[model samples]
Target chain A: MVTKFRTTIAALAASTILATSAFAGELVINTDTSDPAPKAAFEQLIADFEAANPDITVKWNLFDHEGYKTSIRNFLTADAPDLANWYAGNRMLPYVNAGLFEDVSDVWEENGLNESLASAAGSMTIDGKKWGVPYTYYQWGVYYRKDIFEANGIEVPTNWDEFKAAGATLTEAGVTPITIGTKYLWTAGGVFDYLNLRTNGYDFHMALTKGEVEWTDPRVVDTMNNWKELIDAGFFLENHSSYSWQEALAPMVADDAAMYIMGNFAVAPLREAGLTDDQLGFFQFPVINPDVPLAEEAPTDTLHIPANASNKEDARKFLAFLATADVQTKINETLGQLPIHKDATVGDDKFLQAGYAMLSSTDGGIAQFFDRDAPAEMAKVGMEGFQEFMVKPDRLDAILARLEKTRQRVYK
Target chain B: MSASRASRFNQRSLAPVLFLAPAVLFFLFYVIFPIFQSIQISLYDWDGLGPKTYVGVDNYVELMDDEAFYTSLKNNVIWLVLYMLAIPAGLFIALFLNQTVFGMRLYKSLFFFPFVISQVVVGLVFTWFYDPSYGLLNVILGWFGMGPIAILGDETWVTYGIIFAGLWPQTAYCMILYITGLNAVDPEQIEAGRLDNAKGWKMLWYIILPQLKPATFIALVVTVIGALRSFDLVSIMTAGGPWGSSRVLAYYMYEKAFSEYGFRMGYGAAIAVVLFLIMMIYITFFLVKMYRDEKGL
Candidate 1:
């Protein structure tokens, strides 16, 4: 009787497994794009993908923005979906290393994505193989007040000396040179990325974040010293550690601050807060050393097929569809971000256009934001160090020592 | 088998055993097993995903050197000590409200409102109240021309600020508990105490205090647990910032295990084990005291 019962249960499980595999036409896509814009963008993209391939019936599962991070681990190995949206660079490293994510180099090769998605190709590749297809990205730069700059006769500060002079002028005029909220820690990272990228160059910055370079290296010290110069000059908004990135916008909105080192996403909020396009403007981060090429931070968002996916053919088709220029253009317009495809045009928004121009012309390189580029453990420890260093510049030596220790642990 | 032998397997002992079997299994599976499992996991080095490697106390060894652990331990100590203030505060409020007066029900409910509101909302409210530029705290300080203070941002003051927010709800809960206990106090004993010129402090000490022992015991148990379980306020208010100076053990464990940039399950388990050991001490003490009280009764 027990053997018969066991056989019956085994048969039931086998049948369910067979049923799931048999439904090849059903393609399940999971993504954490629950925000209004990204949700609408995916709604449009999925509708288009299904319309293009009518044989494929798409099943899209939208996850909450925060909860998806932890849930993705469970779903990947237990009940895998065909496609998942995630960030590029080291953020996807763990999954890649664990063999949970499928290699999509064939998709890149078949679709000629290497040339078109060139800017993001470097980030998407690990161990000389493409892991995913990048769909969208947004540029990070110094977003400043145009009216304040005009009033103070600041001509966008092309170099470090000019930047400092501009800041000095702003200070004399009783205006903050920069406003940032390091309360969440990543804002400090954005500042650090620009500083490090400028002071040590993009390749060096990437090497450091990847844990090849020591945190206490002389080049890193140069970056920190430059950051300390700004801190000593009192260029940052006071009490910024008390605010979130959104709360920090208040100073810029009220014209108390002139500039912010932020992503293109900040434009919409700034405009919503009553700053006209005429009043708000964007500029690339200024050059600190003439020898280093100009690098920009633009975090890429990609979609991948899980290694355990049942509908491999349909998933590949969906990825190819997502990589198309026209689709990228339309989705990015709705999402208010830049498309990965080289030929895709940015939206009509001034910030978007400016970001597109700056990124396309960048000779140095592009970096995924600090959190995405670094391992998770290192990122958390490093960002905390960055925030602490900003708030307490005297702790720089201690902070660097701690970050070095974290690097030693995380990489191993 | 003989009929007498078969009949000896009676319902008396079997019935009680059979009835409690399901509950015991559930307790073992859900409660007792997880405790051992967490302790076992604490010795391994694993991210939430992938194969776990047996590191054999390496996680604990690393935890010993972890500065965040030390900070969390210190904060937890502070939380434990300061959280005791809630018990006495609740008793005083309970005593104040125990009197018969006009429209007293409104006053009592109003005082109970903090406990009724969810902890997340309380955290958010307190977050805004401590906002450096434009919070109620800063506004009050500004009235005296002392200027703004970033309560949640300052590492030295952040844990205390969150603890105060936690205390608001905790004190109210203790007040409600005391109020319920107050209802069962013997009136004859109180009348005799009053006749013996035992009023105010003396009456409360000799007659009222001894009777409220059960309530105090429950209050002590709940408050101690609540202090150790403080995660919501810390999570919502500052997220263990500015730079993780506000992390208690529970929050630190959560940060290590589940935060966006964290997945060190082994480290998280180690932290959980430490917390569990601390809680075990309290639980064992409570059980002993409860057993003694039962024996005395």
Candidate 2:
């Protein structure tokens, strides 16, 4: 009786495998964003794709950020998704080197995504092969409370001395100059990158992330020292460590904090906190030294497919659909992120509008987010070094030396 | 007839093996095999998906010099040592409620409530409890004319604060176990100890504690394992932050394997192997005690 039951189960397993392989019917997609509106939009696109290709059915799996990372890693080692959403910068580099993601250069050309989002497409390409389409992109810069500035009679600064003077002005009025949460570590790095860009230039920033220059180098040392000076001046909120980026916004909303150096995604939260357009403002992170060449703010996001995808053709179609103006506009409207497609309609999201203007002005010089532009291993070490410097400003040399060692190990 | 009788003896012995087949298979497939696989993975350099490069002992060697690794190890030691205080603390509470009193059962249930709820809920509750502005702890501290202290933000206090939150449930669990043990304590032995003028701490140490050995053993086993397996509370509460001061070996291993950081599966497995070795030390002691008890039985 046991033998009969075992034989029946074996027969069923063989038949299921044979049926799935024979039909060429199933398409699986994985994504990280769990926002309801964006998820619903993606599902609608999936429905349209299924309708267009009667023989194919798309299986959608969406996971929140943390679980998405774990599930994607597990899936890559087992059954990979046909299409996946991933970060483009250093995040994709490890998987690309491991040959886990497919080389979709042909699809990039066939679908015209290369010409559509040339700058973003360039970042997605490594070693002259494009690995993914960029669905959305955004800029990072200073978002300050206009009401506080107005109340304090301070103008936005466009240079290093003026920025410091503004910090001084805000401090005199008993308002904290910047609200940041270094608990996550990345928030502190965002400030460091902006400072580095201002102090040296985008090229030097690129060089540091690429590990061509030691973090202990004079340029890096000067940048850290500048941040330490700001910190010593009591420029940041008191409870920065206990607050997340969102939580830090509370003091800003209450007019206790004056400015936040953040990306465009922070705009929605500002609006949700009841800040009007006139009450808020932004600026390109000031150029600290005039000798360093000026460049644009960061632009980065991702859209990619796996190498082991069973439905490669369907994945290409999905990439094309995502690159379309309609889909990009829908995503931008729902997510409050800038569309990679130039033709996509811009929403009333002021931060995203500012991002579009800033990005359009710089044609030749665009850098991805520091962490995204660099390898993940180095980014992790570098961010930790950033936090260490933030906490113990006097340990600048030690932190830089440790990061230099990590860069040496990682880059080699 | 002699040959047939020998075959019958073999068949009877095989029947007992068949009875234990399911349990043996389950343990092998789930618990035992995964441990061996983890050790095998530790020897390779794999990003989890691609071809694993054989890098024997390199991961372990690098881990030795890793500052974050050492910090995590030190933090785990602090957690284990501090977490053991729950046992004596629980015993005290158990004694307080051990007497015949009104609503004793209800009081015991309320005391055991923390153990019944999920750890995630406990973490969230404690996070609010320690919140600098709105938390109950800070509000109560304010009555003494004290300013709000950044419990989670301050690196020096973050790990200790998390351990305090952890003690909430751990003490409750130990209390319930001790209450059961207290009920089973021989009344005659207590009366004999009382007549000999043994009371208070002396009575507890010489008389009651010796009789509560089984409960104490179970409590220690659970506490040690709980301390080592403490990932969820730390993850939900601090995420090894306030400048990575709260990171334990378990949380750090998960972070290395699949966070925004590099997915160095082999490196992560090596960390797991270290954690396992640390755990095995306590597990060995527990097994020996159990073995001795079994022999005595």
Colliding residue pairs in candidate 1: none
Winning candidate number (TM-score):
1
Clashes of 2: 2
- Write one digit per residue (lDDT tens) for candidate 2, span A51-138: 7778788777777866676666555534567878888766788778878889989877887877787768667888999898887777
Evaluated on chain A only, model 2 obtains a TM-score of 0.90
lDDT of 2 by residue, B1-297 (tens): 999999899789987898889999999987898798789888988766566789999999989988889889999999999999999988989989898988989999999999999999999999889888677989999999896987888878999999999999999989999999999999999999999999999999999999998899888888988889999899888888876788999999998886767578889999999999998998888888789888995
| Leading candidate by lDDT | 1
Ten residues in a row with the worst lDDT in model 2 chain A? A14-23
How accurately is candidate 1 docked according to DockQ? 0.57
Candidate 1 chain A least-lDDT 10 residues: A13-22
**Model 2, position A267: C-alpha lDDT score:** 79
> At residue A158, what lDDT does model 2 achieve?
86
Give the DockQ of candidate 2: 0.55
Candidate 2 CAPRI-style tier: medium
- The local distance difference test score of each candidate is 0.91, 0.82
